[model samples]
Target: MTLIVGHRGARGEAPENTLASFAKALAAGVTRVELDLHLSADRQLMVIHDPTLKRTTGVRGKVAQHSAEDLQRIDARLGLPGWPEPCPIPTLEQVFGTFPDIEHYQLEVKSGSTAQSRIVLAAILQLVERFGLQNRVVVTSSSRTLLRTARDTAYPLATGLVEEYGLLDPLKSARRYQCRFLILKWTLCRPTLIQQAQAQGLHVSVWTVNEIEQMQRLIDMGVDSIITDYPHLAMRVLA
Candidate 1:
């Protein structure tokens, strides 16, 4: 059976990447969730997607420029309607604390384009060790260098490669990183690719899928996991 992984914590139902959104996903019976990470000025792993706060929180500045305590004040509702007011940014530690029952988590590290971005990998690895979630989390990045850094940390953790768009050979990429999972872009997922990856011992997990038809298609393709903004739709389609 294909498992549903909430995209940015049920992004279609609630604000993206917030505790409220994650809670909604878990309530919908989603055992896994996908989230993004950026380093705060104090080096805390903030859970918002964008490097700048303009899009999500409307706070106009680089996320790395603000201290965690300061970033907590801005609302991350992304100005969407119906969500509670003052939806502050959530730390990775906060998300882990709030939803301890989630079976699996896919965390994408959004850092700078270069090697400097790996600065947060050590912190994330430390948290994974502290939380005892070493087996439950997969750290991924589109940047191979950063992904390698995570794999080579003092306490290395499970690693996955977020394909650079839809073109890279999933099986080869997984082998290169020694990644057990491949975060395949939703559109790139096909039965042939899924079969090929699986044959190579790589579990294929497609991302950001929402439509029922597409969800059903992926399920039929036998993907190991489907990451969707609408976990409800994925559940229904699979059901």
Candidate 2:
């Protein structure tokens, strides 16, 4: 069966990367979820998409500038006016704590430098180990440095190469990094590429797929998972 991974924990339904968003995804019967990670000023792993807080939190500073405590208290519901509740940014630990039984987690690390990537990866691995979720998590990143760092870890951490554009040789990069998954931008998903990735023992997962027709097409192409903003809609369509 093709798994449905909630994109930023059902981003279409609730504020992205917030606890409320994750809860909404779970409520829609999604077992797999995808969220982004960035290090705060205190070097804590925070669940948020952008390096800057202006998009989600309406703040002027970068995510790395704020402490995890301060980030968690800020309202993340900027574009989603329907959601009256204050959706605070969550720490990765808090997410794991709240949804311990989630089948899988795709944690996308947002790091610009190799040093920062190493620090983030170490923190993530430590948390995964503490939760006994080493088998349940796949550390994903667009940065080759980050993926390489994850691949080199002593822990058997599964890593995924996230390709937003087909700019790089994705298959070669994925193979080079020994990634188990190739997460492609939905537009980059094609039958031959998908098949090639699968033949190389890589699971193909596409991101931000919201339309039912497109979802069905990808499912027909035999994708391992569809990372969608509406898990509920995907569930119904897939069912």
lDDT winner: 2
lDDT of 2 by residue, 32-97 (tens): 999999899999999989989998978899988989899989899994777888989899999999
Measured against the true structure, the TM-scores of the candidates, in listed sequence, are 0.94, 0.97
Candidate 1: lDDT of 37?
94
lDDT of 1 by residue, 1-239 (tens): 89999999989988998888899899888989999999888999999888889988766889999999998877899746678665789999999988888998999985464456556777887888899998998888787777666556533677787874766666776787788788888878778888988898877889878888888888889999989998887788877
Q: Count the backbone clashes (under 3 Å) in each candidate.
A: 0, 0
Global CA lDDT computed for model 1: 0.83
What are the lDDT figures for the candidates, one per model?
0.83, 0.90
Candidate 2 backbone collisions, by pair: none
Error of 2 at 207 (Å): 0.9
| Residues forming the 10-long window of minimal summed lDDT in candidate 2 | 147-156
